[model samples]
Target: MRLVESRLTLTVSYALLALFAFIALFPIALLVLNSLKPAAQIVQNPLALPETIRWENFTNAWNHARFSTTFLNSFIITGTTIVLVCTTSSLTAYVIARRKIKSWKILTFYLLATTTAPIQLYIFPLYFGFAKLGLINNIFGVALIYTALYSPFAVMLLRTYFIAVPKELEEAAIVDGATHWQVFWRVMLPIVSPGILTVALIIGLNSWNEFLIAITFLQKQENVTAVIAFFLLSGQYSSDWGEIMAAALIIVIPVVALFVFMQKRFIEGMAGGSVKG
Candidate 1:
C-alpha cells in the first residue's frame, strides 16, 4: 500500500511538471514554426506547420539587425562588466572578510545595505553626468557604469562566501612566508572558484540583457542590440511578426544557455557551507 502511494505521488508530481513545461515551451515552439512560414500563410493558419521553409527570416534578421555588431558590442560591454565586477567585488569581499577591521566591517554593512532598498530613480542625474562627460553611446562608459552598479551585490555574495572560507589555509601560507597578495592569489582564490564563476555568470547575464541602461546610455544607432531589437520589433511593421519573434528568440538564447550552464555553480555557491577560523 505504501509503495503504491509513493508511486502515485511521484507520477502526479511529474505530470504537473510536464504540464508546466509544455505551457512554457508551446509559445516558443509556435513562434519558431511560424517564423518559417510566409506571412500570408501565418495569418491564414497561425498554428499550421510551414508548407515551405523560409530560411530567409534569420538571414534578414541577422543582416538588417546588424546582429554581428550587436553581438560584439554586447560581448564587449558584458565581458568588461564581468571582469570589473568579479575583480573589484572579490577584492572588496576579501578585505571585508579577512581583515576583521572595524572600518572594513562598517564599509561592508554600508554596501550590503544598498541591496535592501536601491535608488532606482536617481539614475537620471548620472545619465546627465555621463552625457556631459561625452560617455553616452560609448560601450566602455556603459560597461563602467554597469560594473559599479552590479558590484555591491557581488560584494555581498563574495563576502558571504569568503566569510565561510577557513582562514587557517591562508594563515598557514602566511606562516610559511607568503605575503598578503600571495596568500590571496594562491590560496583564497582557488578555494572560491565556484563562487567566482557564479558571480561572473550573474553579472554577465545582467549586463547582457539590460534594457534600460542600454537604451538610455547608448544613443548610437549601431551600438546596442537591446535598443535595436526593441525599435525593430515595435515599429509599424507589426505585420512582420515573424521576424520580430525570431529576433527575440535569438537574443534570448545566449543568456538562457549561460544560466543553464552555470546553475550548478550558483546553487553550490549559495549552499552556505561552514567557514572555519
Candidate 2:
C-alpha cells in the first residue's frame, strides 16, 4: 500500500510539473516556430505550421538591428560590468566578513539598507549625476550602474560564503609567510569560487538583459542591443512578427542555454554554502 501510494504521488507530481512546463514553454516554442516562417505565411495562417523555413530572417535581423554593433557594445558593457562587480563585490565581502575594522559593520549595514529602498526614486538624481560625470550613454556608465545596483546582493552572498570558510585556513597561509594579498588570491578565493561563479552568472545575465537603464542612458541607437537595437523592431509599417520573434529568439536562447548548462553548479554552490554555514 505504501509503495502504491508513493507511485501515485510521484505520478501526480510529474503530471502537474509537465503541465506547467508545457504552459511556460509553449509561447517560446511558438515564437521559434513563427520565426521559422515568412511574414506572409504567418499572416495566411497565424497558427499554421511553417511551409518553408526562412533561415534568412536571422541574417536580416542581424543587419536590420545593427546587431553586430549592438552585440559588440553589449559585450563591452556586460563583460566590464561583470568584472567590476565581481572584483569590487568580492573585496567588499572580504572586508565585511574578515576584517573587524571600525565602521565596517556600519558601512555594510548602510549599504544593505539601501537595498530596502527603491531605485526608481533615485533615477532623476542619478541621471543628473551621470550627466555631470559625462558618463551617460557610455559602456563605463552602464558598468558603473550595474556594479552599484548588483553589488550589495553579491557582497551579501559572498560574505555568507566567506564566513562559512574556516579562518584557520587564512591563519595557515599567514604562517606560511604569505602576505594578505597572496592569502586572498591563492587560498580564500579558491574556497569561495563556486559562490563567486554563481554570482558572476547572475550579474552577467542581469547586465545582458537590462533594459531600463539602457533605455534611459543609451541615446545611440546603433550602440545597444536589448533596449535600443531590439526595440526598434516594433515601429510599424505593419508588424513584422516573424522578425521580432527571430530577434527575441536570438537574444533569449543563449541566455536560457547558459542558465541550463550552469544550473547544477549554481544549485550545488547554494547547497554547499548552506551546508557549510
Candidate 3:
C-alpha cells in the first residue's frame, strides 16, 4: 500500500509540474509561431503553423525598430546600471554586515520601505528635477535613475551573502596589515561574487525591459531603449502583428540568452544568500 501511494504521489507531482511548464511556455511558443506568419495569416488563425516561413519579418523588425541604435543604447544603460549597483551595493552591504552598527536596523527599515514603495509616487518629481537639470533624453541620466531604483534591493540581497562570510577572513586580512578597503576588495568581494552576479543579472533584465521610465525620460528617437523602440513599432490605426512579434522576439533574445548562460551562477547566488542572514 505504501509503495503504491508513493508512486501515485510522484505521478501527480510530475503531472502538475508538466502542466505548469506548458502554461508558462505556451505564450512564448505562440509568439514565435505568430512571428513567422503574415499579419493576415495571424488574424485568420494564430494557432495555425505558417504555410510559408517569412524570414523577412525578422529583417523588417530590425530595420523598423531601429535596433542598431537602440540596442547599443540598451547595452549602455544596462551596463552602467549594473556596475554602479554592484560596486555601491557590495560596499554598503559589507559595511552593514560587518560593522554591526546601531543604526543598521534603521537602514534596513529604510531599504525595505524603499523597495515596497511604488515608483509612481516619485516619478513626477523625478521627471521635473531631471527636466530642470537638462537630463531628459540623456542616456547616462537614465542609467543613474536605474541605479538608484535597483540599489536598495541589491544592497538588501547582498547583505545576506556578506553576512554569511566568516568573520575570521576579515580578521586575518586586517592582521596581515590590509586596510579596510583592501579587506573588502580582496577578501569579501571574492566570496560574495555570486551574489553580485545575481544582482547584475536581475538588474540588467529589469533595466532592459523597463518601458515606462524609458518612454517618459527618453523622448528622442535616438536615445530610446530597445523596448521603447519596439513599442513605437505599433501604428496608431493599424499594427503589423508579425512585425511587432518579431520586434518583441528580438528584444527578448539577448536577455533570455544571458539568463540561460548565467542560470547556474544565479541559482547558486540565490541559494547561498538565502541560507543565512
Candidate 4:
C-alpha cells in the first residue's frame, strides 16, 4: 500500500509539471505561429496555421521599426549598463562583505533601502537634472540611469558570493606582498565571477526590456531602443499585428538563445549565492 501511494504521488507531480509547462509554452507557440500569418488570417482565426508563411512580415517589421538603428542603440545601452553594474556592484559588494570600515553596515543598509524605494520618488528630479544637463536622448545617459536603478540589486546578489569566499585567501594574498587592489583583482574577483556573470545577464535583460525610463528619456527617433521602436509599431487605432509579432521575435530571440545557452551558469550562480548569504 505504501509503494502504491508513493507511485501515485509521483505520477501526480509529473502531471502537474507537464500541465504547467504546456501552459507556459502555449502562448509562445501561438506567437511564433501567428507571426508567420498575415494580419487578415490572424483576425480570422489566430490559432489556425498560416496557409502561406509571410516571410515579408520580418522585412516589413525591419523597415517599419528601423531595426538597424534601434538594435545598435539597445546593444550600446545594455552593454554599458552591464559593465557599469558589474564593476560598481562587485566592488561595493566586496567592501560590504569584508566590512572594511565601521560604516560598512550602514552602507549595506542604505543600498537595501534604495532597492525598496520606488522609482517615482526620484524620477522627476533625475529627469529634470538630466534635462538641464542636456543628457536626454543620449544612450550613455540612459545607461547611467539603468546603472543607478539596477546596481543595488546587483550588489545584494553579488554580496553573497563575496561573503562565501574564505577570508584566509585574502590574508594569504596580503602576506605574499600583494596590494589591496591586487588581492581583490587577482583573487576575489576570479572566485566570484559566476555571480558577476549572473548580475550581467539580469542587468542586460532589465535594460533591454525596460520601457518606462527608456521611453521617457529617449525621445528622439534615432535614439530609441528596440523596445521603444517596437512600441511605435503598436497603437490604439490599428496595428499590423503580424509585423508586431515579428519585431518581438527579432528582439526576443537573441535574449532567449543566450539564456538557453547559459542557463546552467545562471542557475548555478543564483543557487550558489542563495546557499550561503
Top lDDT prediction, candidate number: 4
Ranking by TM-score: 4, 3, 2, 1
The parts of candidate 1 lying over 4 Å away from their true place are: 1-6, 226-238, 266-277
Cα lDDT, model 2, residue 20: 100
Question: After TM-score superposition, what is the CA distance of residue 214 in candidate 3 from its true location, in Å?
Answer: 1.1
lDDT of 2 by residue, 1-277 (tens): 3545677898898899999999998888888899888999988986788999998888877777877888888888888888998999898898889865788879788878876668788888999998898877787887788888888878888888889999899999999999989988999899998888988887888889898888888877765655457777656322778887788788888888998899886666445435653
* C-alpha lDDT of candidate 1 relative to the true structure: 0.78
Task: Assess the local accuracy of residue 80 in candidate 4 as a C-alpha lDDT between 0 and 100.
Answer: 98
Q: Where is model 3 poorest over a 10-residue stretch in terms of lDDT?
A: 268-277
In angstroms, the error of model 4 at 197 is: 1.2
The worst-scoring run of ten residues by lDDT in candidate 2 lies at: 268-277
Candidate 1 C-alpha lDDT tens digits along 14-64: 899999999999987887787777677788888898898877777766766
Best-fitting candidate, measured by TM-score? 4
Which residue pairs of candidate 1 clash?
none
Candidate 2, residue 270: Cα displacement in angstroms equals 7.9
lDDT of 4: 0.90
